[model samples]
Target: MHDEYNVQAGLNPRTVREYDEAITRVSLGYKSVDEYYSNSCSCHVVQHVRIPLLCIQAANDPIAPIEATPYSDIKDNPNCMLIVTPQGGHLGWVAGDDAPFGAPWTDNVVIEFLEHLQKNASKPESS
Candidate 1:
């Protein structure tokens, strides 16, 4: 099934499964599948990251199911913020209420957040 999805995306499907199976076998041999994923997968990796991270997830996104996002892990990480809007397909911020189509709302929000971070960050002590 995963192979079929890769083919649909115009990629050579043969390599995907082969690579995954190889990695899985190695992980199992090491008896560290959980540890490997904990350090690699974004779901687990996010928990240990110390920087301020804002995750804007669209609730209606089909490719990335809302249920899969590790909410408990995110909550545990003091630096992570999970903002789930009601609508917005993969990176699609087509907001209602006279919202413009071209200027994605998400980009604007991200920009504002970055600016706020810049303002809050401690300045360098120059000689």
Candidate 2:
């Protein structure tokens, strides 16, 4: 099912099967493949983010390959930060004390980022 959407179905209109069309219709409530592609692609709107946006992507992720990353779009956005690590598969940032088990390394990174935000929230901006 996952492959049906990410790999085979989402490839192109020519590659989309009847099963994929039905799944998109039922699950996503999208009327057509064109609509699905237009709405589902983040590259279309990532640059429009008004707030600080942190995007951590694994360079070797199989599900969402690094080549598809919106590098140019994100680079132009002052509020967006894109971090592409050499490793970490999909959501598998297994490291720190949690290696081989427990939470991912992103837990600590996210917490630290939030903590920094909280600490700096009260500070006045420099002229």
Candidate 3:
């Protein structure tokens, strides 16, 4: 499914292969896939990301399953919200039958969240 999404997103197959090779070369020192996957330094280090985080997870996403998402940790953070949709296969919620790109729902939800954040941010702080 991820492969299909990559292809659909206009990623050249050769480019994908090159990316895989790059990762493989960089991971040569790792003892195992688990070791590579478990490395904390390898993950994105976002310190004090003040912006509100809205994580949208598709319940049926095979690539990023619900259990795989660090939702509990995200929700525990002061500035984060996790939304899980029951449908939409791994970023497959293409909006409108004739739409050229990704799902309409994705845009709608993201926009709504941003608007809400903006409105709330503009409000004067209470003494």
8-94: candidate 3 lDDT, tens digit per residue: 323333543343333532445544334544553212322344678777888988655566566546755777777788987778777
Local accuracy by lDDT, each model? 0.68, 0.75, 0.60
Displacement of residue 111 (Cα, Å) in model 1 is: 0.8
lDDT of 2 by residue, 8-108 (tens): 44445452335446456446767665566667778989979998788899998875678768999999998888989999978988976747697888888
Could you tell me which 10 consecutive residues in candidate 1 have the lowest summed lDDT? 1-10
On the 0 to 100 scale, the lDDT of residue 99 in model 2 is: 76
Q: Over the stretch 1-127, how does candidate 1's per-residue lDDT look in tens digits?
A: 1112222422333543344344543534433434444444477587888999999998988656687688999999999988998888778895456676566787778999899888778677569
Minimum summed lDDT over a 10-residue window in model 2 is located at 1-10
Per model, how many backbone clashes are there? 0, 0, 1
Best by TM-score: 2
**In terms of TM-score, how similar is model 2 to the real structure?**
0.71
Clashes by residue pair, model 1: none
- Identify the runs in model 2 with alpha carbons over 4 angstroms from their true place: 1-26, 31-35, 96-98
RMSD of each: 7.6, 5.9, 7.9
Better of 1 and 3 by lDDT: 1
lDDT of 3: 0.60
